[model samples]
Structure formats: C-alpha cells, structure tokens
Target: MTDEHPHRPRLAPLPEDGWDPSARELLAPIPRDADGRLPHVFTTLVRHPGLFRHFLPFGTHLLRHGRLAGRTRELLILRTARNTRAAYEWGRHVPLARAAGVTDEEIRRVGAGPDAPGWTPADALLLRAADELHREARLSAATWSALAADHDEAQLIEITMLVGQYHMVAFFLNSAGTPLEPGFTTEALPAATGTADDDA
Candidate 1:
C-alpha cells in the first residue's frame, strides 16, 4: 500500500499530444480523462499495439462477464494487487472496487488479507484463494474444496484465471513501472495481519 517503494518508469507513456493511430482502435474501449488521455497503464501497453489489442478482449471479458459477482471479483483483484505490491493496479482498481460496493474499510482491510475481521465466510474464501494463488501459484486442496462448495465449476475457473491474469498484469505494471494516473494517489492501506506462509 505504501508508495514509498521506488518506482521508475522504464518505458515512457505514448505522448498524448498526438495519439498513435495504430493504437487508436485499441484505445477506443479504454476510458479517457477530460484531456483524452488514457491511463498510464493503457498508454504503456499501447506502446505495443499488437499485444494491447490482443490483451483487451480477454481482459474485458473477465471484467464484464463470468459467474463471479462484481464484489467478489474486485476483492480478488485488490488482494492480488496487494500481494504483488503492484501500486498501479491497486490505485486503478480501488475506484472500480468501490463502485462494485466494496466499502472503504473493506478495501483497507483487503491489505490485511483473509484473516482480517468482519469478512463473511465467502469473502474470506475469495481472499484465501487469491493469497494461495499468489503464494503457491495454485490453491491447496482445502481451499479448492471450500471454493467448490459455494462456487460452480465455471466460477471457480474464473477465480483462478482472474488471479492469474492480475498476476500477469502486476508483472507488466511493475516491470514497466507504470505510473499512477494524474490525480491518483497511492495511499498506504493496512498491512497484512499475517504472512502468506501462515496456515489458512
């Protein structure tokens, strides 16, 4: 949650003075600021238009479809963002997570992870799934069983895919050093109550 971690932009964002026509089609789906500038993440990706074009459809599907509820999806995303220490991802999703009915306190608590107080059993399961995936790259049998009890096979698959997708996203944002959008702040959230090594 801390912005104290040094972040240096390795690739400059595509200048807004004149958008790349090659990437214009891909940029169409992304929300833009009043200045018509895309988020640094998208603009950074736009530097490779082919990859951005290919990545957007799957990303859009995950955001818009799937059996996972919006709240649940955001919970997983926020936790994954925290786990990876991806400040760009965390900053970008906080608003979307809030819009999906995640409380400010809940957003703050996500950094504390699955063990934080006040999460429902289902919410806890979602966080635990994300943590397990982040730490181990796969869910333990116990976590999988708990997830399967409530989520259908499709939803379970979406959960796994969503976590993996965000992990990839975090890697890109971190490695490329994507900056937070203008006016965005990387305020510190609560720290995790326990490490990922702790028993679930």
Candidate 2:
C-alpha cells in the first residue's frame, strides 16, 4: 500500500570511508528483493555506518542461518510487530509467516492477543513471553516458567534475542515513519480502537 506518509526522509547509501566495502559486499550477496529494497525506516539506519554494521551481522545471521524453526521465529516477530505497531514489520513478515506454514487465520489471531481462540497452549506461551518482554522489558516469573517448560536454554536465549531484535527494528520503523510494502497493511486488532480491550 502506498504510505499515507511518504514524504519522510529517504536514507542514502552507506559511504565507504567509514566501513569496509568488502563487508558490505559480503552482505550484499544477499541483495534485497524488489520488495526488500523498497526503502523503509531500516535503510535510514545505514546513514551511520557503524550502527549499520553492528546490526547487519545479527540480521544476516537470523535471516540467513539462525537455527530456530521458522514458526517459532515468526511467532516472536509477529508479536513484536503487533506490540510495537510496526507496519513495515507486519507487512513483511505476514507473508513469511504463511510461507512457514502459519495459516492465514492463525496469523490474523496474532493481533487478537492472549484471548485469541484456537491458539495452542504453546503458542499462547510464546506470544505471552514476547508480550511480557516488550511491555516490561523482562519476563514475569510465570512467563519464564512456561517458557522454560517448553524451551531449552539455547532456544530460550534465541527467543529472547529475537524479541529484542524485533523490538529495536519496530522502534526504528515507527519512529522514522517507515513505509509499509505495496498492498500490505497492519491487520486491525480485534478491538478496532487504538487501544486493546484490556486497556480499559
């Protein structure tokens, strides 16, 4: 969908003086597709080569070689997208989630929060952990206990890092007014208003 607010600043390409061209070249082997190339808030970050380089390896690792199952990764990502209201992230990952076998209905229910019907207990726990992490910046004892029951230490670390990564991504996208992809938009939450039902 055309961004209602497209007049925001477009980030320029990274300069060579501050960073190794070889590293960028290494990263560029994975060129963003037409969709990925669409300038968004993320591109703006490249303006600071140092910050871009720091973030690049982790993003590359996660997208290219992370060991987590796609379903689990997408669950964490979707919860971050919804919690932070990052339209760019939601627009991109919704399709990725489907490709990983998350049904359209299940993806829709992500915005439905904890009460979303049909979520498996495991799914609820994962989403809740993401929510708790986003809101309070730490997992509650109950949430940590639920996650511990289902995930080993490595997986738990991956999940926490993934949530933190997406949280940072969403922060940039929202703060910078990143554009959503063509024909994509954030799904409306069940309550329709800006606030969730429980907020009342």
Candidate 3:
C-alpha cells in the first residue's frame, strides 16, 4: 500500500477544553474508550453539533440496526476504506469485522478485492459493488441482480447506503485529519498486492 496521505487537518478534532455544553451533551452517551473519550471522528465532528446531531442516528442505524448481516456490512465497510484510502476508517472497522466472524484471511482478501481467490459469488458481488459505487456512484445491472438474488429490498438499500456513508466518513476523516486515538492498536488494512489496493 502506498500509505500516501499528504493532507493535513483543515479543521482538527476539537480539543477537550473547547467542548461546549451542547457538544458535551451530544458526546456523553456515545461509547468511549478507557480514557472516557470518544473517537477522534466523534470529537472532531462534535465541533459542528448540528451535523453531529443529525449524523448520529443515521450512522448508528447503519452500524447497529441495519438489515445487512454483520459480516456483510463489514466487508462493504472495509472495501470502502480500501477504495478511499481512509486510514482511520479502515483501522476502526477491522475489529468489528473480526467480531462479525470475518477471519484474518478474509480481511486480507478484502484489500485484494472481490476477485481474489476463495470469495464466494455473493461475496464478490459485495466488493465489486463497493468498487463500482466508489468509481461511478452506481451499480451495474449484473451486480444489482446478483445482490438481489440473496438480499431483500431493505438489505439492498442498506448496501448502497452503507458504502456511500463510509465514503462520506472517509472524506471527513481524510479532510479533517482525524487522527487515530492514542493507544489504539489494530492491524492496518492489508497492503496492496494489486491495483485494487493502493492503500487502506
């Protein structure tokens, strides 16, 4: 992987002292680390409470309550992380992928892309869907048909939304310079073995 990120934060994560009551209130219920601090994405975004407030429910729903299976959702997320080269987003979702029963080998294959050996037909469709959406914002008919064969309408919709949402998050984290929280420890996106994985 290239590991190329020349961009710096145009607006850094809001520091603790800068958190106003509204920001504090919004961040309070969010899961926090051992230090009782939210993720960089949350703290940085709390700087804009209006957007933060609105983003919470939508993001939480996709991550927690969506119709997509956990492993399925994580595959799409990890693929988005790879396509966008969003390091922070990639780092965060990996453990979630693990918890969802995505094995170490499968995680590596996500970076290699949908065509890598061992992926089932359904799994390939998911990764290809992410790549297509990232490149063109639309799924091909074949991809759509393949996905539809297994997934209901709700799951299909969630698939598009999930990929798009992470693309947006990648934009924010990359542009805002959301740093990995201190003491965070997780393996990075698997390094690229082909053009499909320039970085993650």
Q: Output the number of the lDDT-best candidate.
A: 3
| lDDT, residue 189, model 3 | 54
The per-residue C-alpha lDDT of model 1 at residue 79 equals: 88
**Over all chains combined, what TM-score does candidate 1 have?**
0.90
Alpha carbon lDDT of residue 10, candidate 2?
49
Error of 3 at 166 (Å): 0.4
**lDDT measured at residue 59 in model 2 versus the true structure, 0 to 100:** 85
Model 2 TM-score is 0.79
lDDT of 1 by residue, 38-79 (tens): 888888888888898889889989998778899999999998
Sorted on TM-score, highest at the top, how do the candidates line up? 3, 1, 2
The residue-by-residue lDDT of candidate 2 on 33-150, one tens digit each, is 4655524444456655577667878987886578778898998898778777677788788888988888888888887776577999988888887877877788888978888887
Find the candidate with the highest TM-score and give its number: 3
Question: How big is the positional error of residue 135 in model 1, measured in Å on the Cα after superposition?
Answer: 1.0
For model 3, residues 12-112, the per-residue Cα lDDT tens digits are 87888888899889988899878877788998898889999999999999999999999999999998998887878988888899999999899888888
Q: What is the model-wide C-alpha lDDT for candidate 3? A: 0.85
**Scored by Cα lDDT, where does model 1 land?**
0.83
lDDT of the structure predicted as candidate 2: 0.70
TM-score, model 3 to reference: 0.91
